[model samples]
Target: MKAAVASALRAARRVLAACHESPDGDCLGGALALCLALERAGKRVVVASTDGVPAVYRFLPAWERVTDRVEGLGSFDVAVALECADLERAGRFAPVLAACPVLVNLDHHRDNTGYGHLVWQDPQAASVCEMVYALLAELGAEVDEPVATCLMTGLLTDTGSFRYSSVRPETFELAAELVRRGARPDRIYELVYESRPPSAVRLLGLALSRLQLSADGRVAWSVVDEAMLQQAGARWEDTENIVETLRSIAGVRLALLFKVEPSRVKVSLRARDGARANEVAARFGGGGHLGAAGFVARGDLEDVVRQTLQAAAAEVQTGSG
Candidate 1:
């Protein structure tokens, strides 16, 4: 894998890098870190995301380099995708990625489709940023302040500030290296966790009011419709941490947050030790890590919620049995 990645990098001068749509911290951070590292290596690179950089991640170093449009993007020799399970997860940018002669998929998702020409899908990886750090080390790229700060953001967020089970000793080791290279944990905490907009806070209250638990108390869920978001003046990004709120409830082994969109319902799932959220999400044509996963389903809000809840409950029951 190292040889292949190195060869791909060496063979390409102009590189295009992208992450999945509605990118979370891991995807955004990994992309930013890789772009910066490649640039430092004297490679011309363009970073992109279908949703672009969220306001919360705007503080990330080189976040401004991410663009949403790739329609007229010129030809590139290699495209490196971070934290993307499949090409389609790139949304409208998938076609742009396909145009590349060489593609590298770097991800930690358990169900990555292995679609790229050179795939580095490590399910054991806590976050894509971790893998990117390893790659940078192997590629002899400079892990300067920009790279460290970007990679650390992914580590902090994907591990739930080191609270998730996916975090290992090696994860902290990598984090320490990043910190030594100039990543500031306190600043990241302030930007990501403490910088929530007032509208997001209001949305949280509204979402909590609709929280419901399954009869067994093994599953907890809440649905946030368009109207609820409008009332709260909240955007979809504002709901980022709300799923964690559901997962924190007593006796709830699985938590779900459903966001109703114009043509589909976006569902984020979080599960405890015995559950696999990725399995539940896969049933609806989505994929992610075992502890955290998500899917998008097209249907009426109520219907999608019912279907997702049923599948999640079934997954919990199956795991228990």
Candidate 2:
């Protein structure tokens, strides 16, 4: 994997790095970290994402470098894909990636579809940022302030502040090293967890009020419709982590949040007590980790919710048994 990555970097003078649609911190951080590393290595880099950097992540160093559209971004010698399950997960950048000569897929999701010229995936890694950190070290690129800050944000967010089961001993070791290199945990915590907009709080209230539990009390779900977004003046990004609120309810093993978009319902699923949310997501052509996954369903919101809840309930039953 290192040899392939090194070879790609050596042959590339211009690189394009991108993440998944509606990207979370892990994907964004990994992409940004790699962009910084490549820039330091004297390569021209463009960081692209369909959703761009979320408000919460704008505090990271060089966050402004992220661009939303890659339509006419020209050609690149290599494209680095971070935390994307498949090429389609790149969203608007799919065509741009197809135009590139080489794609280096770096991810840590077991369900990844494995579609890249140079693929390096490790489900065991807590996040793709961990893999990026290792890659930078392998390339002997300096982990400067910008790189450290970006990578640490990924580690903190993906691990749930070191609370998730995916975290290992090495996670902390690397985190400490990043801190030593100028990553500020206090500042990142403030930017990500503590800096919620008022609209988001209102949206959370609407979502919580609509939360419903399954007959067996093992499955829980909520809907954030267009009406709710309009009422609360919240964008879809503000709905982040709302499913975690549902999963926090006592006796709930599987939690789902369905948000109504223009022509699709964005679904976020979370599991507890061995329920594999990824399987439920996969039934609808989505993929993620064991405990968290998501998908976009194009159809009537009510119908999509019904189908998703049914699958989620089945997983809850299977997990309980």
Candidate 3:
């Protein structure tokens, strides 16, 4: 699979690299790393992200190159969808990628839909950045300072600062190699984790204040509505990490966060070992890793929260049994 993707990329003169909608560090970092490497190899690369780069990830090299527009960019010889579970997960850029002659699906999600002409997926891999590192080696592209920094961003963020169970010995070895190639783990950590804006802090406080626990103490949840955003002067992106925070509570096996938008409620799910958060998310047409997943449902905030929490409670009950 690596050789196939490398061959396709080498053959293509113009390439489109796209990140999933509501992209996190893994998606943007891997896509940008690829873009930088491809540009060095003399290929014309355009990185697209419908939701654009979040402020926290703007420090990644070549992040400014990511554009939200797809029109008038012309067709590409190949299009690479990074960290997208399915083509539809590409969001607004889905049509553009589908129209490409060669579509490459590169992801680390367990529920990947297996779309695209060529796919390279590994559910066991810690992050797409890990796969991108291997792909660069397959293409014989240099993992220079800039490329290393971009890849490191994904590695650091996706592993939850090396706190997740997904981190393995190889993950650390890869991080060391990236550091030797000029990636600064300290700076990356500070920028991505420690440098939240004041508004984001305010939003986090609001979300925590609303945190609720199920009767059995196995399911935990919180809601972030438009009113909270307005009150805190924060954007929806500020809601990041709130679900993980919920999951950290003692005896809480399943945690959920419901973000009420104008048209839909976006629910983020996080669970400890043995709890299948993705299964719960799939009940609402969503998918993700066993420990982390999300879904979007169209309904009143209270209704969506009620339905999702019921499903989460049921999942916890089954896991405990």
Among these predictions, the greatest lDDT belongs to: 3
- The TM-score of candidate 1 is 0.83
Local error of candidate 3 at residue 123 (angstroms):
2.1
| Shift of residue 149 alpha carbon in model 3, Å | 0.4
Query: What TM-scores do the predictions have?
Result: 0.83, 0.84, 0.86
lDDT of 2 by residue, 1-321 (tens): 967897788779999999899888988998889888889889999999998887778887788989997666888999988888889999999888877889988889887899989999888899889999988888889998889999999999999899988999999999999999999988898889998989999999999998899849998889998889999999887898799999999988889998888878889999888899999999999998787899988999878978888888788877753
Put down candidate 3 lDDT per residue, 1-321, tens digits, no spaces: 989999999999999999998988898989999999999999999999999988889899989999998788898999999988889888899999999999999988777889999998988789999999999999999999999999999999999898887898888999999999999999999998898889999999999998899849999899998899999999997898788899999999999998888898889999885889999999999998788899999978878878888898889988843
Question: Candidate 1's residue-wise lDDT over 173-216, tens digit each?
Answer: 99889899999988998998998889999999999988999849
Query: Relative to the true structure, how large is the alpha-carbon lDDT of every model?
Result: 0.87, 0.88, 0.91
- In terms of lDDT, the poorest run of 10 residues in model 1 is 312-321
lDDT of 2: 0.88
Ten contiguous residues minimizing lDDT sum, candidate 2: 312-321
Of 1 and 3, the candidate ranking higher by lDDT: 3
Task: Return the candidate ranking by TM-score, descending.
Answer: 3, 2, 1
Order candidates by lDDT, high to low.
3, 2, 1
Please report the TM-score between candidate 3 and the true structure: 0.86
| Candidate 2 TM-score over all chains jointly | 0.84
